[model samples]
Target: MSDAPTTYTGAVKPGGPADVRELGGLTLTKVAVDAQMSNNCYLLRCRSTGEQLLVDAAAEPETLLPLVGENLATVVTTHQHWDHHRALADVVEATGAATLAGEADATAITEATGVPIARTLSHGDTVAVGDCTLEVIALRGHTPGSVALLYRDPEGTPHLWTGDSLFPGGPGRTTTPEDFDSIMSDLQEKVFDKLPDETWFYPGHGNDSTLGAERGSIPEWLARRW
Candidate 1:
């Protein structure tokens, strides 16, 4: 949406990155497809219960259907970025899954994907699927409505599906005067500082990382410091 180059673009391959890992009894799969060449999506499944949550479906519905099976509980968009919501309509129609995005993203989601969102989410809201719970954390640097999902494992390690908010080595860009300060401060205090050191980061567009790994990069964000 910011004219930034899209990342994932290619034929819909059957398998994703071979090294897909299982954490906290959930199978995490990354689907890298679409014109942006971005990490178009992620499928989080509870291995024991079989319930699933689809995060940021970036391609057409048909392209994502094979990757998502009958157990999908809901589709949650991290933000209203075009690459992230391009396939919203198809997914909703195909799975009949309720779509949820940040409260501020509902309008854009409806406009871009032509589908009325079933619910709006905000910080602290919890969406439950099977035995897993995804707690919403508003992370608005990249976009006004961007949010992250936090899942705490039994061992106390937190797994974050940080849309485009906090990436491997840097936080998402703050493109305007109003969003630059408030969002960055919120991220540092509310997200970065609060997350445990061992938290795993499953971002929207890259290889997975850990909170400790990203913590080392905070200094780089000094230039954008509020």
Candidate 2:
């Protein structure tokens, strides 16, 4: 896999393929697989312990397995979305890594893939990833149990893994008015209103973006109501 020039602490150039970048003490390896949709799979590793976390088993397990290394500690599903878990079973089978998902969608994700969820996470819960920690943030509306993970470096800079909840230009696809409103509320309170401008966000699909670059478009996204 080629290394993308971008990193959580640096600017991202959209359309980059498989790449590995550093985030202080952690290493984030990204790969965009062509599946039902353009799904981005991330492998995060703690430099100190080599314990790794694989975020969103999107697709192409054969390709992802190598990047994930042998120290995988957990395989976390962002939501119960089929596209995001197409390769979940494969990766888990290969790595024997514990599976995790939001409590609400835990059963569905397990039933659909036959890869039992080892643990169900709730909002504000911290997932121990080797020497590092990632906080869970529930993001509903995309899927009833959608979630995003926030990893704060030693310097306090935040790096979020937004699984189809908040994207570059707007929130994820929500059909009904109620669903749209729910997602919008989650994005506002848990995201925009809280995180710092320089926080780098890695979405489930496509390129990554910083909070500062996306904050200005909230009003426009609201006006569009998508």
Top-scoring candidate (lDDT): 2
What is the per-residue lDDT of model 2 for residues 1-226, given as tens digits with 9 covering 90 to 100? 2233344332223244467777766888878776447788888988888999999997778777887867788999999988889889989888899999999989999888999999998989988789889999998888889989998777546889999998888899998888888999998999889999988889988778889999999889889998
Q: Which pairs clash in model 2?
A: none
Decoy 2 TM-score against native: 0.91
Clashes by residue pair, model 1: 6-36, 7-36, 7-37, 7-38, 8-34, 8-36, 8-37, 8-38, 9-34, 9-37
TM-score winner: 2
Per residue, candidate 1 scores C-alpha lDDT tens digits across 25-84 of 666666766644555487888878998889887775666887786667789999988878
Worst 10 residues of 2 by lDDT: 1-10
Which runs of model 1 end up more than 4 angstroms from their true locations?
1-19, 224-226
lDDT of each: 0.75, 0.85
Which regions in candidate 2 have their CA more than 4 angstroms from the true location? 1-17
Weakest lDDT window of 10 consecutive positions for candidate 1: 1-10
Clashes of 2: 0
The alpha-carbon deviation from the true structure for residue 9 of candidate 2, after best TM-score superposition, in angstroms, is 10
